[model samples]
Target: MILVGAVVVLLCWLLGFWLLWHIPAPGEFRRRAGRAPAALAVPESIPLSVSVVIPARNEERNLPCLLQSLAEQTRKPDEVIVVDDHSEDATAAVAARLGARVVRAPDLPSGWMGKPWACWVGANAATGSLLVFLDADTTLSPEGLENLVAEYRVQGGMLSVQPYHVTLRAYEQVAAGLNITLMMGMNVFTPLGDRLAPSGAFGPCVVCSRADYFATGGHKAVRSAILEDSFLGRVFA
Candidate 1:
């Protein structure tokens, strides 16, 4: 029994690593081609009106950080909408206070999770041509929104960014295993990743044209999905 258990654990580790090795890390190809990683190549003027939609549920404290980040963006969003998902806290008040247009998410319908439902509500209320769906807890760098918009203009597809956790303490290393596992699921790191169909989108930050979003049915189509990111990826695919 002990030998069998050892074999099972070994197989699981091997399988995990195999999956991990197949995904290409960002800028890997650039390095291989003897080129440096590309800088944020945003143009001087972006024609499309951009909307930053945040989905929040009891995130009053975290909202300020993300909202502040948005305020400091090099290219500011034309509009910011916060979908307050039935929070017990003052999420809506805080978002409105920060100049975000707050939309109170309706009572969750059957088979819908709070996050996706909130996202759907915000998307519908958004008036911009370009839509950026962000989680309440995500705080972007000064140029993050600009860089993302630039990528969307160039790539012309659903774009998702996985959150990069910045850890200064050794204790945060405890998340290393989970983080690596999550990255494996993204399937974009392997040397030949571009040749293969992408497996899924990350949940925290996603961008796309409003037309494509509605055409693919957006979060409304994945109302019941727990892994809304992966489902949204397929819908866009």
Candidate 2:
């Protein structure tokens, strides 16, 4: 019985190591370091038009910070649209106060989720070559939008960013397990990363070409999906 238990323990250890080995480190993606202004400058070429779309449902408290961060971006979006998804709060008012175009999302239709529907409304109203979808709670760095644009230009497909979480409450720390599991399960830490399955996207921040978004039917294709972001990633891929 002792020998059998030892063998079982060894197998478990080997399995754990194998799983860890396949996971990819976040640093491997070269996400840091924005391109220099000089390197980013071009000779009188028309810059790509980018529109930011935010879906808000009772996001009155979060909108202000996110909008402020967006306003400070090195590469500003041509337009910012916020879709108020039937929020009883001042979500629309807050967005308007911050100079964002606000669209009141229509009542939820049959077989549709709130977020995807709101996003679809925003996407339809956007008039830019690139569409950046951001969650209301997300705050960006000054160079965040610039980096996203640069990365998209190079990658020429959907780009999703897993925002660095900032926790203030003790309970928030407990979410680390879920975060780690998500990364590992989605193969974000694996050698193939998103390429292997195109199975995951950071719901807080997603960027893609307007044409590509529409070509994949935007959020409409995933209207009822609870995991709309992940479904969209697969569609874009």
User: Which whole-number lDDT from 0 to 100 does residue 30 have in model 2?
Assistant: 37
Clashing pairs in 1: 23-189, 23-190, 24-188, 24-189, 24-190, 25-189
Error of 2 at 32 (Å): 14
- Go through the candidates in order and give the clash count of each: 6, 3
lDDT string, candidate 1, 1-237, tens digits: 999999999999887766766543543434443443443222336578999999999999999999999999999999999998889999999999999999999999988988889999999999998999998889999999888876665466788887787777999988877777767776565555565677778889999989899988999998998989888887887
Q: Where does model 2 exceed 4 Å of error? A: 1-46, 192-195
Candidate 2 structure quality by residue, lDDT tens digits, 1-237: 999999999997775554455543333333422444333322225368999999999999999999999999999889999999999999999999999999999889999999999999999999998899999999999999998887666556788887888989999988877766566556544445445665677788999888889888979989999989878877876
Instruction: Indicate which candidate wins on TM-score.
Output: 2
The weakest ten consecutive residues by lDDT in model 1 span 35-44
TM-score, every prediction: 0.82, 0.84
Which regions of candidate 1 are displaced past 4 Å? 1-18, 21-46, 168-172
